[model samples]
Target: MALLSPGRLAALHQMGATETRVLQDKPSDSYERGYAEDVDHIIPSPTLFDSLRDQHLVPDDMPAISQCATHLELLEVFHSLRNRVIQSRYLDNAFNIHPSKRIVYHRKHRRQKKVGKELRDTGFEGRREEKWKYYLNIATARFEQWIQGIDTAMNDLEIPPCGRKVLPPLDVLVVWHAFLLNPADFKEYCLKKRLQHVQKIIFPWREIHEAIDSTTWRFTVPADQAGWILQTTLLEPDLLHTLTEDSHINYLARDLLRNLSESRWYNLAANLRQANDRQSAFMQTIHAAINNQIEHRPLVENVQRQCIFVDKMHAHRWIRSPAVQGTLTRAVDKYENFLELFRLYPNKFLVPTLDVDLVWHTHQCSAELYRGFVVDRVGRFINHEDNISRGTLDTGFTSTEEWYQLRFGEQYQVCLCWYCEAILSAVEEEEVKDGGSWEAVDVEEIVERVGEEVEFCRDLEISRQKGRRLPRWKHGAGV
Candidate 1:
């Protein structure tokens, strides 16, 4: 039986946490209904498993007991679980689930079209890069404030770590989703900031979606919960007001900072900076800066420096570019090859550049497809380990570069961009100086934290699919 931690149990008892009432949902939209139906149709039958068993595709070490089910049978169970998770987390209208990359790419395209048109309409005199940067600067600054708001909510809720929940605005959720895709950076940022709630808080995605109506893009809080939330947090009681506040943008974060200071929400604005003295001084400086009317460029640069998410957002912009779009198919092909390399040598860890990683992320979004792909091609479940240290990641990347060159007769560095090149060179230089010290470090602590499924001792029997060649790319990726 599972046991709760003493601290958590006490928190739950003190807070009087109640089970959420299951509210009946309204009829789903056409797209949502269709998607749910499609998922339901994918559920496999025992007869299908029997055919696979006859074909020697699955292990048959157990009798037909639910507790002692075959591997294929377990797969069916997990598949059904996944369907339930999707239904509850997504299709049930509890939370606003952001579109996958497939759908999101189109949304991004539309956003770009809007931004470009706005630029033209305003007669902004700048290069294409400058125009895009202008938009990114505003967006990232807004995202930084949104993160602070989330922190405020998390800290205010005096409940167990996992029990505290806040509904993020849809626009904020979009940025947060991108931030999470780079798991290492995201985890490290939260840990470094001592954001325990941010790190451990359970996202009631369906609930958040339901709270925010999809058609109107408006939000509502349950009347019973709203009172407590308003009293405990800095947020407005009416979620519509919070939504409006989130929709507002500030390029230098001047407006947001002023509001925080005015409300005496110094701790939240200071971002959990531990020392009382430091927090006070920081808040004073911010207040003085606002009063003095800080220069635009310096404040913008400062915001950019403090915003850890800007880099990933910038990287995503490049990924969504037409050049990357042209080469996406090639990147997917490379990603398959990367998986095949893992299949060939299961003991070693590998790392992908941003381009290939994008493809890997998209595949994993479709849980069923990802499982099938890895099982058929790699012969085992290839888990994506997100929490990794920089040292470990660099080592894996360097090793992958060498292995890829030897196996594919090609350089592993796909992007010729200055930032990518700098990273590539820095890793190589560090490797030379350290003399492969990373290999000597405790790998389990730093590298990919994989599960017991990784078989290193013996070649496990696999239902390998027929191999095929992917078309070669004439151009480099990660523009």
Candidate 2:
């Protein structure tokens, strides 16, 4: 930057290039910046200045830019002709200008190197706590790899091994297991550590507090056994064992099953979705048999029970909801059944009584019909409050990638993918994404158009308010 032409430097500054500035006082050429101290350079290249001026059309801001470089006279005019040519080519891709193809998009992101590749010390006579982390990393990595369907630890339950030293407490490891497993839902540190509340059954409070007191000497598990051990503990609880299935236990088991590279869940999810498409109820009932394979039944039951309770309480509001149009009466046909079942079995029953309008569009006609319905009806529901299909309108188009980009800008594409990912049947879109384009709508262009529309709408709002026409600039200043 110091060697750039005065005009070029000022133009960059105007276009928001970062420059080192002296806060207290402007530093002189002699003032030492640590990074510059070791560097060596050649004499100013006069040809660069001439070449830059000749080949590249100089910007209008060059005069002002030349003044900005007044203090940088001693700065060498740097760069080879090729480098300068490449550099000067993209100056116009500044703010408020739509980014150009000339500007680099999709850079290869740099990531920090992973840990635990280094060999651990042979002896235990070291910083036990610090060494514990080496093993913790191994355990975490194995579980993560397992989750991602990579070759991982042998025991589905255990953490991987590290060096010869004390390990992190079982409590913390269990929390990590839950976190790495349920990346969503259990996001908060406090919420995750809440699972540490379960650790008391395996390692008592006295032990946990002692580990806290002397973190360095804490007893750690083998990296491989770390994950497996938690599952063993989950199996150990007699009280939870009494239940046919427990929610917490099911959740932990689900995480363990996810990392099982040998497991057929992913293949089944894809295949079962096909079976589900042909006959939704058949697949829905068969779901119970499938969850038993992964021991995930309780988690599903727990979520369903919760939704059922909420729906039961809010029956009047949504049973004949203004938010849903079709078959309002038919959707809650089970309302009478629900009342009878509740009388007999209390809270043990759930009658699927909502989202009737938000029908699985695929089931309605065919995949094509669903896509058409999304593009037409669901898209129209965007700004219309009176329109039914609230649940469908909100969650449906999101899977298609249109609603997200329309409501939020292109930057939110990642967030939208994460949000509607579970429901997205990428039928064709998956291939489109792999080919480097997923969006049907140009989000940035849409945002600009929407902004214009909003500004136009403001005129109506302004007209409703009282205002007097006045001079563009009022004169009470100097007078």
Candidate 3:
């Protein structure tokens, strides 16, 4: 994308790449009928009108007039045309009585954003996404080959090409056809699937539905009564409607006690109904509380105009301080080079540097010693009373400006370690003070408070660090 300019890209077109050809489409094949047909026929400038022919499908009868400017637009043309045909098919089929089958359509299907992600742990990633991604992989591979072909063709030309080269509309469509011909392109489409039948509503809903369904034998073929229970209590349009599609137990168990006229469901249904009532009432209360107690408006920070906050990317128009992107570009040296230069130097003369690989394995104990040193230094900075004379400091450590000046030189580092410390403090305070309330301390407010504290401490010098260590429970982690 960076290689091609907008002017060059716009000028590019695949002229005379595809010829008007008869599409050899057969009925049984679902994929070959849609975009594949359009590409095979090599129809140009196909509008919405051109798409609908031969029972609302792309027909080969239309003249090859429509053309895509680029391979990318051609791909879009393929999808937009194909989706129109397939989506109509689905919508039309929706009228046909869909049998009582447990179709597992994902409610929140998403792609795992982290590249080379696991096929498992499908909290968001769904089967549909898997199928589409698989198809896209095939298409991308085909497109790469097509681009390679175009490059080869350009090289064959006698007159030397200058700047970005353009491919005509026909070339774009031809590559698109190659993309569609890739077998992975149409694997496992939605319409081809027939979902597995759920044996019974299991667990929570299993016991509930079974208590109604199986108990039909206990009362001399109580079939209509069963239908009534399902339709009214569970809110299914009919008994044939599959409840497993979105199995919400509370909604399914509505009016369960009233429906459970049978003696067997008496005790269990009674207990369940009471719990359900409480849950329903509590849901309403939650909604009401959210409406009254929470501000729905998007929060904008307006007050704090002049910040010298560190941990950069804090851009404000009125801010006095400039943002520093980084302190050290290359802080670590190669182990052999570093050792050759400084290993013979006296302990007092040498500034310490971490040989990380060595610390990770051989000299691991040294890491713990360094960790204790930092922890002690931070502990002292937080505990000193003179540093925090205004409001009561939280129990956990926050980096003050005085701490910064004492440890790292005064203006050398604008330490906003206070933000991290405040976040930890807020979380701890919520767990203790919030009780059942869900409202948490505003993180922005913590930032503002930290700013105020830093403003106070930036000028003043204060003594930090205690002389000795006291006993406390120590926690350790390992790689």
lDDT of 1: 0.38
Ranking by lDDT: 1, 2, 3
lDDT of 3 by residue, 301-380 (tens): 10011011111211110011111001111111222222222323213122112221121111111122222332443331
The lDDT values for all models are 0.38, 0.25, 0.24
lDDT of 2 by residue, 1-479 (tens): 12123553344333221112221122223222222223222111122223223211322211111111110121111111112222321211210112223322343445744333434344322222222222222233322222222112213423322211112333233323223222223233325433322111111212222222110112334444444433332111111121114443333233222223223353345434433222322222223333343343223232223333233323222111111111222222222232233334333312222322112210121122222333453342111111224576445434424422343333122211111111122212333555744445343343333333222222211221223111111122100
TM-score top scorer: 1
Off by over 4 Å in 2: 1-296, 300-479
lDDT of 1 at 354: 65
* Worst window of 10 by summed lDDT in candidate 1: 456-465
Count the clashes in each prediction: 9, 16, 12
**Candidate 1 on 345-462: residue-level lDDT in tens?**
7999999876566556544432334456578878987766555678999999999988888888765665423222222333334456679644443323211211111110000101
Off by over 4 Å in 1: 1-172, 175-316, 319-322, 416-479
Q: Higher-lDDT candidate among 1 and 3?
A: 1
TM-score of 1: 0.30
Best by lDDT: 1
